[model samples]
Target: MGTIWTPKLNSYSGAKYLRLAQAAADAINQKELLANTKLPPQRRLADALGVTVGTVTRAYAVLEQRGYVYAKVGAGTFVRAEESEFKNKQINFATCQPPLTNQISVLSDAMSQLAKSPQRLTQLMAYHGEPLKEHQLIFSQWLHKRGITQQPEQIVFTHGAQQGIFAVLNGLMQAGDTLLCEGNCYPGIHTAAVQLGINIEPITLSDEGLDLSELEQKIIAHQPKVLYITPNNQNPTCIQYNLSQRQAILALTKKYNLVILEDDVNYCLSSEWHSPIWSIEQGSEQSEDPGHVIYLSSLSKVFCGGLRQGFLLVPNLYALKIKQAIHSQCWMISPLNTELACRVIQNPEFMGQREQVIAQRQQLCIEMGQRLGLKQRWRGLNGWLQLALPLKAHHVVTALAQKNILVRNGDDFNNHQNFIRLSIGDAADDKIFVQQLAIIEACIKSLSQTAYSVV
Candidate 1:
């Protein structure tokens, strides 16, 4: 309908198909060809460029595979829509969230029901000094089902998991006290530590779990007040601690009389749903005084992240301190949001749908990784890609960004630069998902061949 599109492929050096594809990619990237613009018919373009129709077809296929354009059967190919300059369109491997399912409809229904109930709305408006008993009971039952048994009294509501992390650190540790954690741990731990003026000491992590010997050595040297861990699907690595590893870590907690801040936020996505480290610590016969582990988890990972609903199970000894810290921070977590989360959790069909969505996404990503020949490990929604020498995470990330794809570098999670953390959270559909991975593969191969370096 617009001007008949013609590409200048002389400056690009590659196979004829690749050169044509590269020209299209460059035009899209440079904004010469805006999103949703239709290309000329294959026969017309082939004649204009003095190339065969088959060449144009292959070139279009390449463009589609790389996510630059998409073809509609009997309708010709058109540029894929670009949502934002920063986010691009379909590929965003940066955030870790539950895959899209019926959550939005569920939330909408819940909101409508709430709007119809004036009394319930009024209740949510008032400030309750403590988390509601009914909500606590619901959460307590939820925890019990997951193998972490606790009284409803011990559970405290938090605005989100990050808040729970901060509350535990601030409630238990002083400004100068040291905290020991995985060398490459959740970035939130570092952020919270900086705010509270707490010192963090890194412990070496092995494939099994934390290097036990290194953990004890750091414990003795630093006399840390707390140990933070993600027992299931450790962030950026997806390494699940085996039973023996859990027992060993629990033993260290008892020996040093150190508190364990157990972060099992990714429990919803874990296929095994293993008993949390907190449960093991509590059930141990050797435990003379059993309140050593502080468990933190959230609905954000399982349901909708915007809900900002999280709950913590604290020991009696530290409950008041953590409660006071929470009060000081935000007064109280929004009761309306909490109510919405409770409704979502109560839905009989929600959990099954959530699981199905997550499984499909996880399988797709695993298969893609296998096909790409990339060394990878996946647990839940996150995948860890290990890059061999002559390939670096930052360079790959930068190259992908140029193509309008976003991903996280390993250094963002830890000091390591050889891995990339891919969160399959924002992908729109299976087609876009495969295309994004193909683009990632192409970027990695191109970088490796050129030995790209960033100075």
Candidate 2:
């Protein structure tokens, strides 16, 4: 080692090992500890920090696991050189999906089980007007677990959440009709509106959630036929509406005679399940008409994205129209895919494994953000980082792209903000995630400095 170094851990609040690791990451980020500098030995570091030797050992191991350093057999651990070129390979933090887990093996096992039953496989391969009643029942039970109490008859299967969104827009609204949504909303809504020739009016969102007064004002001004929202964890922004907000929205739908298209696709990745707006609307006993909310969810976030399995729970009045739209588009979703989804969800260990993977990825992202001093907001696997003034979102995005890393610019979702959306779902491993984030941190710092210089 060039010189003995002591890391300050007082500002960090975590387990001793994690705090030490974060301190080291801070040093690396600040350039106080350069690349290829050998780290202090475990005993010396422990004594300097006044902690147990095992804590130092664990902290060093964490550094290695995060791709910050490497350990030689006889030599002490040394900081790894910063990676510059990715050879055109991109580290993606754009598309939102659950982190990689045992989903592939789960699918493989389900496939093996299906292969052994020729009659069932043959049935699944055939065409049908709707999903098998058994499959619908399974999904109904799945929804029940999530606190949604819709019946099996209400379920309409579609290719994925994107298709479900399109089908709803096509079935309910005419070419000239208007739809209301959050000012900063999911990009899919914009695409669907443009394709269907439907006009969209945006309602401003406040710090808490949607600004209720603005929503009502827009509803009155536009006479919109439907309102699209993501209640559990809103896309791009990752803002989850509170119970009071949900109730207020439900009340507005009833007041304006407006239909709500509630997308809860990210609910599966949530650590805590909240009652959906659909459930609250349906469960109210005082209302004679309880069919104001159309619920949409998908198995892609919970299981495998390639399965492309999603479903919508429409009210009795609109079920036929929505099903017709689905039928007119693709006749029916592939029964084989639905069957595979059913099997995956039914696996005894599926839920536990899914929760574990989500928690681990979330924790990793949180730690990375802390070490880099990046302020972020998170929901499930998605995160939003607002760039400071003079440092633009697009510039950071371009810089990251030069290093073969991909992330979504906030403008993709809303033009009024300067931020970037990050989804850790596609990171190959924790080490890769940490390495990419480190690069992202460096890029942002360099751009920030350049921006301040020009000003």
Candidate 3:
């Protein structure tokens, strides 16, 4: 065992790195890794794997993509304490590997074109100027496709959607106003709200997306100014708002005069993805007042999350305020990321890759449904399969950890002790994930009908 290298996993299969990352994440969850653990350098890990540095870079990228790891500029990657503990469950699901498919070339060509064109370079080089009208036009296609009638001019660029949140929050609310959110919302928003000293009132939810009645009641009772919602493929919970619900929510927003912050992050992932609430045509009975909805999205999901490129579609009336806020806090990203995203969206095969992933997700969902039924299942973009094991979810999660398949625990989504959200959705090795999830399901089934909180 002296001066020896062990082949832990194959990076080509992608699932191996995902499994390794998950195993490391699980250990961190149990306080085994401790706070601020300096992970093995990427080069050493790759050397141990007998693989290239690029392979290790990719694996770390996967971990970073799913918010499990953080990179310090000039320093090595380290486990994010809060994120690690949050993902502290056993999942057969692999990390989301952002495959550099052919569409990347499409982005390369755009960069090439941008480099060649002195006009684009001159106009887009600074933080103060507006993005190219062409960039605005391409973003408009994304908007129209998503059922938004917004002019490209209405769309403003940001470093990323996270910045967009800061911008919107800065512009829209004072320190004390409440921002109503879905009960099981994205963690980023939760952190942001807390940081700003803004109170968050979580509306209850289910398969039908938000509880409109409950939300309306909360709106009346609390009088929250801003309403945050992930209407399509809702985070953590795959719950989506149906057409009727959108209509009802719009009515309520107008009634309560709420400034809706619609985080339509996962909008493009679904083939049958419905038009967002803002995209719907407003009429005399339903003329949505201007500045009612501020839409947010990023190329992270469809293009490159590393691009850190986000776009905001704001109502014309409030666009100036949001834009000024963006300028004040998270100033313009390098035009480079925008060039990368604009390039990716233009690729004809870009949508094809999305479709392929969609097919993969459908198969995975079916496969997961068979292996693990609807008892505790919740499906979304990130393979958010919630197990029906109730109190046993924790036990099932811990048992799966022994085998080294990583998944997210459900309590992170909601305080429901019985539910476990299995991450089976995003960029994972489906074949291996299916097999491993089956094993986890078997492990859970074998455990005595007892629920013990592992923490």
Evaluated at residue 321, the lDDT of candidate 1 is 93
Q: Which sections of candidate 1 miss by over 4 Å?
A: 1-90, 267-270, 451-455
Quote each prediction's TM-score: 0.79, 0.79, 0.72
User: Candidate 1: lDDT of 326?
Assistant: 94
Question: Which segments of candidate 2 are over 4 A away from where they belong?
Answer: 1-88, 267-269, 370-375, 451-455
- For candidate 2, write residues 189-248 as lDDT tens digits: 899999999999988777567999889988888898899988888887888888999999
> Per-residue alpha-carbon lDDT of model 1 for 1-455, expressed as tens digits?
53377988889764576678778888887888889898888988899999999778777876775567888888889887776332445467888887654555467657878899999999989988888888888777777776777889988899899999999999889998999999799999999999999999988878888999999999999998899999888998888888999989888887898899999887445555788887887787877667889989998888868889988988888999999899899988878778887777776645544575567777877877776677898888888898877777888888788787888999998758599988886654445666787887777766766655551
Report the CA-based lDDT of candidate 3 relative to the real structure. 0.66
Candidate 2 lands at a TM-score of: 0.79
Clashing pairs in 2: none
User: What Cα-based lDDT does every candidate model obtain?
Assistant: 0.81, 0.81, 0.66
Compared with the true structure, model 3 gives a TM-score of 0.72
Query: Which model is ahead, 1 or 3, in terms of TM-score?
Result: 1
Error of 2 at 245 (Å): 1.1
